[model samples]
Target: MSRYEEAKLNYEKMGVDVEGALTLCAATPISIHCWQGDDVRGFDQKDGRAGDGIQTTGDYPGRAGSFEELKADFLKAASLIPGKKRINLHASYAVFPEGEWADRDKTAYRYFIPWVEFAREHGFGIDFNPTCFSHPMVKNGLTLSSPDEAVRRFWIDHCIACRQVAQRMGEALGDKVLNNIWVPDGMKDVPADRMGPRLRLKAALDEIFAENCPNVIDSVESKVFGIGLESYTVGSGEFFMAYASQHPGVYHLLDNGHYHPTELVSDKIPTLLCYFDVLPLHVTRPVRWDSDHVVLFDDELREMMTEIVRCGGLQKVLIGLDFFDASINRVAAWVVGTRNAQKALLWALLQPHEALKALQDSADFTEKMVRMEEAKTLPFGDIWREYCRREGVSADESWFEDVKAYEREVLSRRGT
Candidate 1:
C-alpha cells in the first residue's frame, strides 16, 4: 500500500477522517503579510527614514525597493505556498501614480487599485492595516492617542481613509476585507496619568468607527509596549478587550507576540470565541518581546491551532501571518512561515478531537495522555507530503531550491 494509504488507515483507527481533514485544510485561507518582502519599509516613505516602534532586523541583500519589486517577490513567495491564500496589506503600501503623492489622510481608493488588480489576479482576498507608526505624525510615540489634537486628528483621518479604501477593495473583490488598526501610542517612561492616553484613544476609536463601511471587518490591535514605549502602552490588551466587549461590531485582534511572555494566545482563542462572532488573529513568533520572528511549526503553534480546531474556531477566526524577518531570504521567510502555518492547521485538523474530548469528560487522563502522545508520532510527514502533492507545492525541503534559484536570478540582481 502507498505511504498515504497506510497513514490513512492508522488515523482511521483514531476516528479521524483523513480525507475530510485534507478537504478542510485546503479550503481554509491564511493571509500572508506583504511587509516581509521589504522589511516593513513601505513605499510611501519619501523621507527615507525607517521609522520607529515597529522594526525589522538584518539588511539582507535584494530588499524590495519599489512596488514592482515587492510585487514580484510577493508572487514568488506566494507560488511556493499551498492551500487557499490571502494577501494582507498595510496602508503604507499604497501604490500611487508616478510623480504624484497623497498624504495619509488624503489617500483614497485610487491609490490602491493596483493592489486590487494584483490580488484579484492571484485569487487572494485582501486584508489591510493602517500604518500608524513610521510616520511624521507619530508625535511623542503616539498617533491616535497623542496629546496634541493635530496629531490625533491626522491619524484618525488616516485610519478613516484606510477603512474606506479597504471597504472599496472588499467591494471590488466581492469578499469582506479585514481592516485592522494598530497604533504604537505609548510612553517610554512612567506617566503620571495613565488614564489620559487611554481615554484619548477611546475617543479616537469612537471617531474612527463612527463612519463604518459594511464590507469592512474592523479589528483593533493592542500591544504591551514598543521599543521606545516600554514603560506604558496606551492601548493595552485589557483596554482593547474591554472595548471589543462593549462594542458590537468591533473585534479585538490578538497577536501572539504582543502579550506578556507568560501568557499564551492559544488559551485566549476560546475565550475570544465565546465573545466575538469574528475573531481576527495575527499569528507570529516572538523569541523575546514582540520580536515578530517568522513562525515555526513548534509547540505553541500546534497548541494554538489545536485549540482553534477544538473550539470550532476554524470558521469564526480569521488567520493572518504578521512577521518581517530581514535576517533571512525574504521570499523564503514568507514560504517557510506560510507553510508552517498551513502545517499547523493540518496538524490540528488530523486530531480526533471528539475522542479526545470524550476522554477529558470521562476523566480518563491516562488514556488521553497516551493517545495524545501517540498521535504525535504518527507518519504526519507522509500526510503532509500528500497534501503538498495535491496542492501543487513542493512537499519537502526541495522547495528551498527554488527559492535559492530565484535569489540568484532575481534577488541577486537588485542593488544594495
Candidate 2:
C-alpha cells in the first residue's frame, strides 16, 4: 500500500479523520496583515515619523516604499502560502486618486476602491484597522481617551470614517469586513487618575458605534502596555472585555503579543468563545514584549489552535496574523508566519477530539495520556505534505528557494 494510504489507515484507527482535517484546513481563511510589508509604514502620509506605541526594528533591505511595491510583495507572499486567505489593511494604507488626499477624519471610500478591486480579482476578502497612532492628533500618546476634546473628537471622527470605509469594502466584496481599533493611550508612569482616561475612552467608543453598519464587524484590541506607555494602558483586557460584554455586536480581539508574558491567549480563547457568538484573533509571536515577531509552529501556537478545534470554534472564530519583522526577507517572513499558522490549524484538526474528550469524561486518565502522547508521534508530516501538495504550495522547505529567487530578481533591484 502507498505510504499515505498506510498513514490514513493509522489515523482512522485512532479515530482521526485525515481527509476531513485536510478539508477543514483548506477551507480556513487567514487574514494577512499589510503592515508587515512596509514595516507598519502606511501610504496615507510621508511623515517619516515612527509609530507612537507600535515599533518595528531592523532596516532590512527591500522594504516597500510605495503602494505598488507593497502590493507586489504581499502578492508574492500570498502566492507561497496555502489555504484560503484574506488581506488585512490599516487606514494608513489608503492611497489617494489623482494625488489628492484627505485627513484621516475625512478619508473616503474612493481611496480604498483599488484595494477592493485587487481583492475582487484575487478572491480575497478584506479586513481593516483604523490608524490610531503615529499621527499629530495623538498628542500625549492618548486618542479617543485624551482629555482634550478636540483631539478626542478628531480620532472619534477618524474611527467613524474608517468604519464607513470598511463597511463599503465589505459591501463591495460581499463578505463582512473585520474592522479593528487599537489605541496607544496609556501612561509612562503612575497616573493620578486611571479611571478618567478609561471613562473618556468608553464615551468615545459609544459615540463611534452610535451609527452601526452591519457589514462592518467592529473589534476592539487592548494592549498591556507600549514602549513609552509602560506603566499602565488605558485599554486593558478587563476594560475591553467588559466593553464587549456590554455591547451586542462589538467583539474583543485578543492579540497574543498584546498580553503580559504570563498570560496565554490559548486559555483566553475558550473563555471568550463561551460568552460570545463570535471571537476575533490576531495570532502573533511575542518575545519579552509585544515585539511582533513572526509566528512559528511552536507549543503556544499549537495549544491555541488546539483550543479552537476542541471548542468547535472553527466557524465562530476569525483568525488573522499580526506581525512585522524587518530584519529578514519581508516576503519570506510573511510566508513562514502564514504557513506556520496553517500548519497549526491543520495539526489541531488532525486531533481525535471526540475520543480524547470521551476518555477524559470516562476517567480513563492513563489511557487518555497514552493516546494523546501516541497521537503526537503519528505521521503528521506526511499528512501535511499531502495537504500542501493538494493546495498547490510547496509542502517542504523547498518554498524558501522560491523566496530567495524572488529577492534576487525583484527585491534586489530596489536599491537603498
Candidate 3:
C-alpha cells in the first residue's frame, strides 16, 4: 500500500472518518473587525470618533465597511462556505479615542457594550482583540513598556474595560467569547524598557480570568517585527511563550505568516502545542515579512499543515484569514479567502505521511524539500478535474457554475 493508504488505514483503525476529518479540519469561523468603514481607507471612522485621521495620505486598500455591513457581508460569505461559525469583532478599532484621554476610555466602553450585546443577540462568538493605538497614551506604545505612567494607566483601564465586556459577553453567549490580546508595545530602537508594562499586563490578565470567566481563552498573539521605538518588545513567538508562562490564564496564539520563511514550523508547532496543552491558532499567508496576504498556499504552509495533522492538533486550531485586500469587493474577498482555506484543509488531509517519511529519510534533505514543495502547490480545482477524469465522469464548466449558483442561493436566503 502507498503511504497515504497506510496512513488512511492507521487513521481508520483509530475510528476516524477521513472524509469527515477534512470537513472538521476545514471548520473555522470568519472573524471581522467592526470599524472597517465603507471607504477603502485603512483608518476606521464608523463611530464618528476623533483622532481617527490617518497620518499618511497613501491610498489604503481593503474592505472598509461599517460593523453591520461587514457582519452582513460575512454572513453571506459564510453561508457560501460550509462548516464555519463565529466571527471576530474588531474591538481594537471600536475602542479608538475621539480626543482627551479620559473621554476616550469612557467612550470606548460605551462603544464596546453594544457590540457585546449584538454578538449575544446574533448567536455568534465574539473574539476581542485589544487596540492600544487609539489612545494618545500609546502613540508610541502601551503596557509596562510605556515611559509615561499616564499612558500605562490608560492601557490598564482599557484592558480592564475589555475584560469586563468580554466577561459579560461570555456570560451572555454561554462563554463562547474568545478574549484575545495582541500587544504592539515592543520597541524598535531601544532594546527593552517595556518589561515592567509586560509584567503589569500579565498580572492584570491573571486577575481578569480569575475573577469573572474561566471559559474564555486569553490568546496572546505575537508579531515577527516591531514598527517604532516600542517595536521590538514582543516581536517573536518565543517572547509570547515566555510572557504567557508568567500568567495563569494566558495562552499563545500562533500566526503562520509571522515567522521567518525558512522556519520549520513542523518541529516548532508541536513544541508549542505540547507546552501549552491547550492553545488557539491563527492562520494566514505572509509574504516576505509582511503578513495579511490573501493569496493561496505556499511551500512552508504545507509543512505547517502536515505537522499539525501528524501531531493530531486540529481541534485546538482556530483558523483565521488575516488578509486585508481593499481592492477586491468586501464580500468576494471573504468568499475567496474562505475557499482558499477550505482548499488548504483538503490538501492537508490528502497528504501521505509515508511520502513525507521517504523524503525525510532520504540521504539529502534538499530532494525531500523539493518533493514536499510540489505537494503543497497541488491545486484543488485541478485535483477535482483529475478525479472526474479517472472516474470516467464527463467534466464541464457547469460544475463550477453549480458551485457559484449554490453560493448565490445561500447569500440570497441570508438576505445579504
TM-score of each: 0.99, 0.99, 0.70
Instruction: Give one digit per residue, the lDDT tens place, for model 2 in 1-416.
Output: 87778888889999998999999999989999999998888888766435877788888888888888988999998988999999999999888876688889987899999999999999998999999988888899899999999999999999999999998998998889999999999999999999999999999999999997989999999999999998999999999999999999999999999998999999999999999989999999999999989999999999999999999999989999999998998999999999999999999998889999999999999999999999898888888888988989899999999989999988988963
User: In the order shown, what is each candidate's alpha-carbon RMSD?
Assistant: 0.8, 0.9, 7.1
For residues 5-42, what per-residue lDDT tens digits would candidate 3 score against the true structure? 45555555433455555455445454543332222222
Q: Give the TM-score of candidate 2.
A: 0.99
Which regions of candidate 1 are displaced past 4 Å?
none
Looking at candidate 1, what is the lDDT of residue 212? 66
Over 1-416, each residue of candidate 1 has an lDDT whose tens digit, in order, gives 99999999999999999999999999999999999898888878786435668887898898998889998999888889889999999999989898999889887999999999999998989999999888888788989888899999999899999999999999999999999999888888989989988999999999889986999999999898889889999899999999989878899999999999999999999999988899999999999889999999999999999999999988899999999988899999999999999999999999989999999999999999999999998888999999999999999989899999999999999994
Scored against the true structure, residue 196 in model 2 reaches a CA lDDT of 98
Report RMSD for candidate 1. 0.8
| Rank list by TM-score | 1, 2, 3
Question: What lDDT score goes with residue 255 in model 3?
Answer: 70
In terms of lDDT, the poorest run of 10 residues in model 1 is 43-52
- How many clashes in candidate 3? 20
Model 3, which residues run further than 4 Å from truth?
A: 1-18, 26-65, 93-104, 107-123, 192-212, 229-231, 234-236, 264-266, 353-416
Off by over 4 Å in 2: none
lDDT against true structure, model 3: 0.54
